[model samples]
Target: MTNTHLPKPEARRQLLLQLLKQHKQLSIHEMTRQMGCSEATVRRDLDLLEQTGEIFRTAGGARYDDPLRGISFHEKEQLFWKEKEAIAAKAASLVQQGDIIGLTGGTTTFLIARALKDRHEITVVTNAVNIAMELAESKKIQVVLTGGVMSNETFELSGPLAEAKLDGLHINKMFIGIDGIHHQNGISTHSELEARMTSIMMSRADRAIAVFDGSKANKSSIFHISPISSLEAIVCNTPLPAELQEACARDNVTLHIADGEPDAL
Candidate 1:
């Protein structure tokens, strides 16, 4: 039972689901080992998981769900720390002094908040309570947290209050994260409130930038915040797939694939 494959689709699916929930991000080798299946079988199962929103495949592994979007900070801390920090550091360089930026919720944005610590005199509005708290101590930067119901699972402020507050403010740029970046639906996430907040923020901004790790590509979600055609740039730590690159080119969106290095900034 330890190293065996559950051949039945229902059995395989159940086992796969259990593993996905238990392991925040399970590597291919790990899946291959525990599931007692061929690499191809594991890949096929992962694809089913991806399609069903039970998991998402990354470069070396697969995360629990579509975005790993609703994870606790403790869970998120386990993945993409260096890469997310570097992504945030690179994202910060895009901010010109005195720019009003709309920020969204997620691990990458948390890193963005930390990177913002050194900057001053920017009006940063966000639905992320963590980001607001992080930037609030800075006397130089004005942090406005939207009034909304807090999501304990994700540490974000979302729902009507958040969207209403964002609808009134027009900013120079907005930085957001995603659960999925599909060619069909563009940027999406699991939470409707969060997704609505994302759309409202982008609508009120001059330019929209979707920030996520390279892991989010080749995925889709139910709630779409904005079409990929609506964004200004995509900032990530890895190169997007050629299809994605070409899609952005067709849409005239700038693709900034940072190599996890701050010197590039």
Candidate 2:
């Protein structure tokens, strides 16, 4: 490909990261061929990404390094993008003016925050650094960021410090993102810290809602957050299994199915 045909620097770098994420590890030759760029350009992109700690430089290539067992936030953002957006929109529709809402870290909740950006007279309580930053510029929404150690993979603040902050606040509603939702295990996540923190947040909220895509249904992760009975409702892209549906009904938990369409920005 010629120079004029090349993507801009930032776009090219983002594409390179996506490529690396999809292929895991790729040599210089492979990346150059895949990216349709010269070897020198691919090398420079790899060097910059490595410097930013986005990838690990190998002998003649780079590999995506995801230290956390769960999928990284960037990777998760790409998976079920439309479904997540739809779930977020459905969750946001439940918000009311002057209501204090809690948001846990995940692509779905992040999109929920975006969906609420233009609304007025609402407050957002969150443990996600990126969500906090996303709402910082909103003139109408009040943001409360909990203090704790931020995870590189999830951008979520957890530990004692974050839990302590939640003690004083009362949330009208909370939209939690979890790795799995099962009939028996209820809801769970990969990180124990996240599970603990999310549980605490749920306790403080009057209504706790789980927001996820279709893939999370009938799945259980390593760390358990709470049982299915604890949730007020669940919003997802597809209908849940019969067992889960029966569980939700027995527990009086409401279920909402999103159309998986893009929310109007």
Candidate 3:
């Protein structure tokens, strides 16, 4: 039997997605029973999940549709959004005028781009098309976009062309967003090409900081970017685990925790 405790709307939808993944498909009655919610609530959740392209609605049920690449940018933008905004605010506070900043692609870093949009005399060097577009109209902030094929999943430019562009330029700071961060394996992402591009960005920057929410803590993805010791600092919404905290301290990595309430930038 499923747990009787009710979850919030977001939590319930996530749980429903997990159930669909395990069963592949599920009838309304089954979901209503397993989720301990009314049939109407189950249907509503299915509709919302379907709209995100994460599931397919059948006549009386739903089926999980695993994304061909990874989660869509639109979908990722919805998850942990407030936390990401808070983290972005904390990151933006570190930027100084005239700083040439490097940004990697992900929802958090995208928010960082948005946070820095109104700043003056700063140049944003990025591989994410979405980020460059976000800062494009800001007359005070110059935007530099790299050249390469873009990833449909991430909208990040990578490969030989992107690497060549970075060879001549330097960044005052680089804020990277990753799929996972582990104390042992360091920071990582799902795509190797994105990882390679992120490493190059790190190498070009005077300071490299990893920005992520608490859920990413202690998790490790498939492609390794750089070790934890390489980071100058980490900005996250929640406190990291003890082991990871110890690792950060040992490596002299500064950990900046953004408060729970997101600040308006």
| Best candidate according to TM-score | 1
Off by over 4 Å in 1: 1-34, 38-53, 57-63, 66-69, 260-265
Q: Over the full model, what C-alpha lDDT does candidate 1 score relative to the true structure?
A: 0.80
- Which pairs of residues collide in model 3? none
What would the per-residue lDDT of candidate 2 be over residues 97-203, giving only the tens digit for each residue? 99999999999999999999999999999999999999999999999999999999899999889989998799999999987888988998889999999999999
What is each predicted model's overall lDDT from 0 to 1? 0.80, 0.87, 0.87
* Candidate 1 residue lDDT tens string, 114-219: 8888897888988888888888789899888899999887788877777777766878989998877877678888888888888888888899988888667857
TM-score of each: 0.81, 0.73, 0.77
Candidate 3 clash figure, as a count: 0
Model 1: ten consecutive residues of lowest lDDT: 256-265
Pick the winner on TM-score between candidates 1 and 3. Answer: 1
Q: Report the C-alpha displacement of residue 93, candidate 3, in angstroms.
A: 0.3
Misplaced by over 4 Å in model 3 are 1-20, 23-32, 35-68, 260-265
Runs in model 2 deviating more than 4 A are: 1-68, 260-265
